[model samples]
Target chain A: MSVSARPEVRPAERAEPAGTAPQPDTWRTRLRRDWPLLVMGLPMVITVTAFWWLPTLGNVIAFQDYNPYSGGIFGSPILGFTNFQLLFSDPQFIRAVTNTLGITAFQLVFYFPVPIALALLLNSIMSPRLRALVQGVVYLPHFFSWVLVVAIFQQMLGGAGLLAQTLRQHGYQGIDVMTNSDTFLLLVTSQTVWKDAGWGSIIFLAALSTIDPNLYEASAVDGAGRWRRMWHITLPGLRPVIVLLLILRLGDALNIGFEQFMLQRYAVGSQVSEVFDTFAYFSGLKTGDLAYGAAAGLFKGLVGLVLIVAANRVAHALGERGVYSKS
Target chain B: MSTTDTVIPAPGRGGPRRGKRGRAPWEEPGSLAGRLGKGGVIAVVLLLVIFPLYAILLTSLSDSRTVNAAGGLVLVPDGISFDAYRQIFSDTVVSRAIMVSTGVTLFGTLFSVALSVLGAYSLSRPGSFLHKPMLFSVLLMFVFFPGIIPTYLLVSSLGMKDTYLSLILPSAISAFNVVVLRAFFMNIPRELLDSARIDGAGEFRILWRIVLPLSKAVTAVVALFYAVGYWNAWFNAMLYIDDSAKWPLALILREYVVNAASLPAGTAGVAGYGHSVPPTLAIKMAIVMVAVLPALLIYPFVQRHFTKGVIIGAIKG
Candidate 1:
C-alpha cells in the first residue's frame, strides 16, 4: 500500500518577479529555448503515459462486455453499469469489500498509535547508543519482503512451529495461530505492527526532535510531571504531524498491502483473507472476467479518489497543506 | 531519525558543566517500579524484533542433527554449518532467482533514478515550456490509481508478458520521487545556474556538475527507495511473468518459503549432495536470510538520511 506524498511546488519568486520579467516569449521561442529540458522529460512522459495513463484510460472496459479474443475494448458491446450491478450482488465481492474496510478500520484504531507510542518511548531513552541499537533492530523488518515476514511468523506460530512444539513438549495442545481464521485480524495486525511500526515512528521522532527542548524545561520548572509534560507539551507538538498522517491514512483506507493477504489466503482461507486487490486479481486476471473485475476495481478507485479529495479539503479546513496544496 | 542526533546538546554550547548523560535538574528520576516497567517494555519490544531474526539465522546455520534436536526452528545453535547455504546455492532455481533479483534491482534502480532526475530537473525550472501542464500531469497520478485489470490487460496486449521489461517499465517513475527530487532541485540558488548559463553551461551540464553533487543525500535516499522496491517486488512478477524459470527471488521465496513446498526432486541432484543434507526448515530459513541480508547491509549507510528525506516530502508536501 503506497501513500502518495504530494510535494507542493514552492513559489518561483526567488528567481525573478514575474511582473518585472521580460516580455513573454512566443510559443516557438519558448520551444526553441526549452527543447533541451523537454528532451530530458520525454522518457518519463512516454513511460508514464504508456504504463500509467493508458492503463487508466483502459478502465473504460468496465463499461463493456470485454472479450479480447472476439473484440478489444473498442469493439466490445457496451453494457454500462451491468458489471457494477453484478459486482454488488456477488457475495464474494461483498465479503472482500467488508474485509478490506474492516481491516482498514481495525488498523486505524489499533495499529496507528503504535509508532507514536514507540517514538515516545525511544525519545525517553537517555543513552543515544541504546536508542540507536533499538532503532536499528526494529527498523530492519520494514525492508524485508512480505513473504519473508509471513515465513518468519509461520516458523514461530504455525501448527508445526516453535510455539506449537514448545507447547507439545509441556503436555499442552499445539496452537496454529497462523491458520486460525477467527484471529486472522489480530494475526495480521500484529504482523503489520512488527513490520512497519518502527519505520513509521521515524516521522514522529523527527517531529518530536523538532519540538523545542525549552518547553519541557519550562514545563518542569512550573512543577509539571512527566505525564503532564507529555500530555501538555509533547502531544501538542506531535499534533500537526499526527493529523497530517491521519488524513493520509484515511485517504488510503481502501489500499492495504495486497501481498500479505495473498500469501496467507490458502492458510486462513479467502473468506477472511480476500481483499479488493486480491479479489480483482482473482476475478479479472485469474478467471478472465475482465469486465466484471474492472468494474470492481473502478468502483474502488473512484471511491478512493473522492475520499482523498474530500480528505484534502478537510486538511485545508484545518489549515494544513494536506497532500497537495493550492498550487 | 537524523533529527534526533541534533537533540543532543553540544558540549561547547552547554559549557561542559552538564555531563554526557544524566537527568536534568528539573526532571525527577523515575521510581524503581517505573524504571523496571519501562525497561521491561523496551526489552520485550527489542526481543520481539530481534528474536525472529536470531532464531532464523541460527536455524539456517544449524546442522540437521541440531535442527532435529530442536524439534522445529532451532532457537539455540548447538552446531554451526554451511550445509544449507551450500544446498540452496546449488539449486538452480534459487541461484537463478538470486541473479534475477540482483539484475532487476540494479537495472531498475538505475533506470528509475535516471528518469526521475531528468524529469525533476526538467520541471524544477518554473516558467519553462509547459511546466504547469507537465507538473499537473505528474501530480494527477497521486490521486488516481489506474486500477489493476486495465494495467494487466494493457501489458499483455503490448506483448510484454513473460518478459523482464514487464517488471521494470510499469513502476519505473514514481511521482513522489520525482516531486521530491524536483523540490530539492528547486532549492538550488538561481545564481549558481545563471552563472553556469552565462558561461554557456547547458541545463544538463548545470544538473550534472552543480545540482547532483550538492543533492547527494536526497538522491541516495531516493535510489535506496527504488532499489528496495525492485528487490522486494513479486506481485508484478506474478502478474506478468507466466514463466516460472524467469521468477525473481521474491516470487520464488513466496512459493518455497511461505507455501512450504518441498524443493523439486532434482534440486538434490543439482546440488550433487545426496548425502548429509540439512533439514528443509534450514533451507527455508537460509532462503529468508538470503532475501534479507542485502536490505540489512544497505540500510545503515542510508539510515541517517531518512529523516531528512522523509521530512522534505512529508511536512513540506
Candidate 2:
C-alpha cells in the first residue's frame, strides 16, 4: 500500500485566485451542480449502510434475548448485561480469549521481525536476477488459499505425510506434528510465517529502496564494515516504517485470522484452536445462541477499538505519526 | 573480469574502481567464508519455498503406481500421466465447483470494481455534496468491524443465505481499495478534468475520458485484489451456503484435500456416484493443484502492479 501521501485536495473547479476566495456555494446550487456525483456515490452509501452500518448496529441484539422466529432483533426482550455476564463466566469463552491473545503476542515477537530480516537478506543480494527469483518464489505461497496451505502442510507433516512416510520407510517411528494440540501455537505460527512472511517483506523492501545509495557509499568509504553500516545507516533509515507497522500490528492484535484456525479446529480440537471469531461461530451461530454469540463478538470489537486507540496514542508518544494524525 | 578479458580495459587504476559482477566500487564482495554462508542461507530459503510446490506438481502429474512408490507425495518424477486430472475433470462435484468459483469470481469482481470506481470517483472531488458523510463512512469501516454473527444474521435475514450474492456482497466493498482509487484519481492533473469540463463535457464524460484512462493501473490492481479475494474465499461459503451443489472450488478443495485427509478412511466417500474405490493420492494432489493453478497462472501479469497498488492503499489508508 502507498505510504506517506498527504491528501492532495486540489479541487479543479475551485482553483480560484489566491487572495480572494470565492463565497461558498449555496446548498441548493451545490446540490444542482453535483447531483450526478451524488448519484454515482449512492450505491456505495447504500451498500455500506446496509451491510456495514446495519450489521454493526445489529450488535444491539448482543444485549437482548434474541430469537429469530420469536421476536427478532427489534422484538427481542432486553436482557441488559445478562448475555455478557454469561459470556465471561463460560470457560470456553475465556479459553478462546486467552488462546487468541496468546497467539497474537507470540506472532508479534516471532513472526513480525522475520520479514524485516528477510528484506535485509534480500537487499544484500548483489544479483538482481537472483533477488527477483527469490522474491517470486517466496511470494507464491501468499496467494495460495488457507485451505491449500493447510493441505500442503498436512502432506508434509501429518500422519501418512511425506515426513512420516519417509521415517516409517527408514524403520523409525513416524511423527504427526499437525495434530499435536500441545504445539498448535507453534504449528500455526510456522504456517503463518511460511504463508505470509515473504509477502510482508514487500513493505520493508520498499522502505529499503528509499534509503539513498550515497549513504551506503559514504559509510563504506569511511571504512565502516557491512554490519556496522547496517546498524548505523540501514536500520535507522528503516525505523519510522518499522515503528509505523508495529503500531498497526498492535492495533490489529486481536484479529489472528479466522479461516486458518477454523480449518484446523476439528483436527487439533477447539480447545487450542478456538480464537474469538471461531468461538463466536461455534457458540453463537452453530449452537443457535444468537445474542450470546453477538455479545462475545461485540465485546471483541470494543476491545479492538480500545487497543487501536491506545496503540495510536503510543505512536504519538513515541513522536511518530500513527494510523491517523492528531487532526 | 569478463569485461577486462574482452580487452576494454580501464585507462588507469584511478579511473573507475569497478568491482566484479557489476558491484559498486565502494561495495565489498566479502570474505569467501561469509559469501558461502550467505549463499547457503539463500539456497535454503529458495528450497523451502520451491520444494513443496515442486513435490505437489510432480505428484499431481504422477501415476498412482508412482505416487504409491513414493509412499505419499512424489518428489522425484519417474513417470508422468494425466489420469488424476482426467478423473477430477470428469467428477461432477469438482467440475461444478470450478464453474461456480469461476462465475462468482467473474461476477463478484465486476460488481465490486464497478461500485468502487463510481464510489471513489464521486468522492475524488473535494467539497462535493454529501461527500463528508460518505467518505467518513468508508474510512470508519477501517477501524470497526461488524462482527461475524451480526453479518451472518444480516445475510440470513436478507434471504441471501444460499445465494451467491452472500459470497460477493458482504465483502464487495473494501474501504482501502476505495481510498487507493480515490488517491490515484485525485493525483491526475486537474488541468485534464477542467479542460474537458470547459469543452462542455459533463462530470461523467470527464471521468470516462480523462480520469479513468489515467487511473487504469490502480483500477486493474483493485480489480485483481477483489477477484483474488472472491476466488480464495471459503469461510463465507461454509457459513452461508448449506447447499453442497453451490459450493465454490475453494470449499471443495478444503473438503476433498484438507478435511478428508484427517478423517479415518476419508477418501472412501470421495469416489464418483457408482465407483467403489477411494480417490488415489494423485487425485488429492490434483485438487490442491486446481485450487493453486489460477493464482500461479495470473501472478506474472499482476505481479508488477502490486507494489504500486498496495503501497498506495497502505500509506493513504
Interface RMSD of each: 6.5, 10.8
The candidate scoring highest on DockQ is 1
Worst 10 residues of 2 chain B by lDDT: B1-10
**What is residue A260's positional error in candidate 2, in angstroms?**
0.5
Query: B122-149 in candidate 1: lDDT tens per residue?
Result: 9887777887777777777778888899
- Candidate 2 Cα misplacement greater than 4 A, ranges: A1-22, B1-21, B261-279, B307-317
Best by TM-score: 1
Docking class of 1: acceptable
Each model's total of backbone clashes? 0, 9
The per-model lDDT (C-alpha) reads 0.83, 0.81
TM-score of chain B of 2: 0.86
What is the per-residue lDDT of model 2 for residues B191-215, given as tens digits with 9 covering 90 to 100?
6776677576887888888888887
